[model samples]
Target: MGWIAVLVMVSVAIALIAFRVLRRKGRDDGDHGASSVDFSANLALAVYLLVLAYAAVLCRDGLSVSEADVQAEAESLTEMYWSVAPIPEAMPVRSQIRQYTAQSIDLDWPLMAGREMSPIPGQTLADMRATVLGLRPVGEESKNLQQDTLDRISEVSHARIVRSDDASTGLESTFVILMIISGLLVIALPWTLGVRPTRSSIIADLVRVGVVVIGVCFIILISHPFSGLGAVEPDAFKAAQRQYDQIDGRFPAQP
Candidate 1:
């Protein structure tokens, strides 16, 4: 992005200027504390890169779990819809399933950017389960069917709760601060290497600072599960809706 390029350029410029000022002020005492600075900077860079890798993994795991939860929820809805196709009286139940999915995709999905979901869709799912519980089936097969539908609804309810929790899953603020500190130390401490600031040395320092910026930016960009371009979408729910239509067209619920 343009913003990213601008930030990297600005950061490199500021770092270079700061170090050049230090050099002009005769701050570099030939190898006076070079070993200590070298050790500290190396340690800081190691910690920074390690934490960056961990944050990347955390973001990846959160997105993967959220995606799996969504697919499971959609699967439960499709299975529930199929289970109730034989009973004409369960028309309302089927309709409620569709309603819940629609509300989730349309209303709740948008709210996920803020790590939230509307209660309306969840309530609709609960009501569907209650309606199934109220059914008085005569035959053993009918009783089994009712139980199956209830189980499917329960699965959907569980998956929805998990998905909501997953929405809030991301890197913690404290961890981000730690990353920033370590990254800056890596950029700043290397100036104590006690070497004269030639053009090539300054350029090498600039490259090091640039790498730090890129790493930090990557972590920040991917730190959230529900926001950003790599966000988990409702594609699973959309596929479930398509499957519902296919099932309905084939079974053709009779009156």
Candidate 2:
């Protein structure tokens, strides 16, 4: 992204320099049309701003959706863990939940960043469902708790699949290319004016170019919610881990 931004800046700088030379020669011949050039440059800038704003919003929405999915998945895991606390016979189910959670955090997180799903986490979760369904309840209270646990387990499983799907989601490559093209146009539009190459005019053009470059770079940085520096963290899963640890150490025993 940085390289792309630099390329844009360099290209704009070279174009401005050539425009300056052309304007200097034209000025000697009294062949300048300042009013017309200014009108066209202003029109181009307006269009560029609209495109940039739309692209920024798209990237932000992608990030928000990814974060929401992570939060929902973690909350479901936490709920599933707590639901098993009341029934002693549900200990095996609780242990399975813990294993599934750990696998999701440790094994699946990296895969998510690469927009890939890990088979082991899904298999671990499947085994957890089987363990939950295999439980037999004796009294009415135990039966109720068993049903609640099963519901929560289903919620967790459903959330896990959604998380995997969200992990694979990102801004389309075509949109990114279009944004880059628009950014190039934004930088080059002013040069097309053939306006006066006054010091203030040149400085103002450079500032506008800088702003466009920075904005496009920001859009690129957040283009992928699961990859790069500003990408969403697995803090949700880590919080779930802490909650599990507070209730019981490493692995809970099965009754």
| Top-lDDT structure, candidate number | 1
lDDT per residue for candidate 1 within 205-235, as digits (tens), equals 8787878888877876777677774888899
Point to the candidate with the largest TM-score. Answer: 1
Candidate lDDT (C-alpha), each: 0.83, 0.73
Q: What is the lDDT of residue 66 in candidate 1?
A: 80
Q: Check candidate 1 and list the clashing pairs.
A: none
How high a TM-score does candidate 1 get? 0.85
Q: Per-residue CA lDDT of candidate 2, range 1-255, in tens?
A: 565657676767776676667577634223356466557666666766777787778878888888898898888888777767666777876777778777877888788877887788788878877877788877898788778877877787788777777788777776666656666666666556545566776676678778767766666677778876468788988898789776555345444
Count backbone clashes in candidate 2. 0
Q: Runs in model 1 with CA error above 4 Å?
A: 1-20, 23-30, 192-198
